[model samples]
Target: MPIHERSLIRPENLVTHENLVIDGVDVSGHWSTFITSRTVTDYNEAMEEEISALPGGEHINRCWQCGSCTNACTVNAINPEFNPRYWIYLIRLGMEEELLRDKEILWQCVSCNKCTYACPRDVVPEAVMKATAHWMELKGHTPKSPSTHFDESFTGSVIATGKIEEGQVMRSFFKKTGQPLNQPWLIALVRGLVLKFPITLLMRLGLSALIRPRTSGWGRTQAALNDYVSEVEARNSKALGLDGKGKH
Candidate 1:
């Protein structure tokens, strides 16, 4: 364990990511860094342009590293790399590629809305974080995070079912992740409860269903979104004299 507050620090050091403190105060030596400023400048510039282009992105540049959003972040409490403050700093500097390559860390955000709840400027930092991660993914960063994968699967699962079917989603997710199915006891318990308990009990099951993301008004909402996208794509394609798909 490193001593508190006095760990010899520099921009190039490769410090252990888990040792979070030196002298009981969080210090940034390794996990808190990125590629050199000279190499990152272009990326930073593009990042700023892309982010500020978003509806709420103008506020992204308004951050002064107050750390309020970081402090309020739930992910930061668990993993140090998931720092909203640092990433926002990266954004302010316009380090687009750095942020893009950092898709692994960036996608760790849970989007719990806590950062937004804590932002004094009402910057909606949580939404910005998610948007940045998604943008990075679209730009070829390729999301490698489990949360991102599960999030997509969960969304797809819910859309397929009126509500999330935990057993179904977990089976799919586990198969995808190469995790050996090991929830035998839980599965048995579920089966037992379903067999012994009333069907009404299953209908009233609130929490388990939440794990699979069963949302109300989703079918109509999804159809509306599909229609909206097709119309926009048709208009856009017409303007470009291309097919209704937004591809070249």
Candidate 2:
């Protein structure tokens, strides 16, 4: 279906004449307005396939342009340019360059699931948005988001020691996202904890922080997890036509 919304049309593409006459008829302003036509030649035909290979993008082929997802998108309500339906349309047609025009706003999906709930084809627009964001990051079209940094920090801590240290995860996440460790809110939180926790418990927590305790017999499990992560990364890279180091 064609997008008939005037706002969706780029101003440069819409041409208008202040005063005009065509075929002995006086037509100006809205009557003389026209959209410029152009041919697209830079399509990435494997885009849909590459996205499908990522988690949460498996059902991209089911989209039928019903517009339900966009109608229910929470982000779209706040930001008109954040259109999931339009992005999916571009992806299905492999219009990679056009899609990249909105690359910065693509990661703004809040995973509200309203779009998913409204989708008739079970497209799961929420997941598709996330997959698209991940694809953009892997393709180097955008940087890793703060949420991605936090997830990696939390996951890395658990995978390394089979347990998570809240303070360590927070520190790592802050470092990766270039945030200061001494925020006022964090300082207040630490002060409250210090005043509330018992002496022995606080000592144990301090000791744990220093020692970086690990789960017993985690060596074999860690090895298996590392192997799995490597395999998934290799598969994703292959799907995106990237080398082992994620370079094309």
Q: Each candidate's TM vs. the true structure?
A: 0.59, 0.78
Candidate 2 worst ten-residue window by lDDT: 1-10
Q: Write one digit per residue (lDDT tens) for candidate 2, span 183-208.
A: 89988987887788869668877887
lDDT of each: 0.65, 0.88
Candidate 1's residue-wise lDDT over 130-224, tens digit each? 66765565444574457666775676675554677766667667776777555798678778888887676666566455554557667887777
Q: CA shift at 233, candidate 1, in angstroms?
A: 9.5
The candidate that wins on TM-score is: 2
Candidate 1 worst ten-residue window by lDDT: 32-41
Q: List the residue pairs that clash in candidate 2.
A: none
Task: Identify the leading candidate in terms of lDDT.
Answer: 2
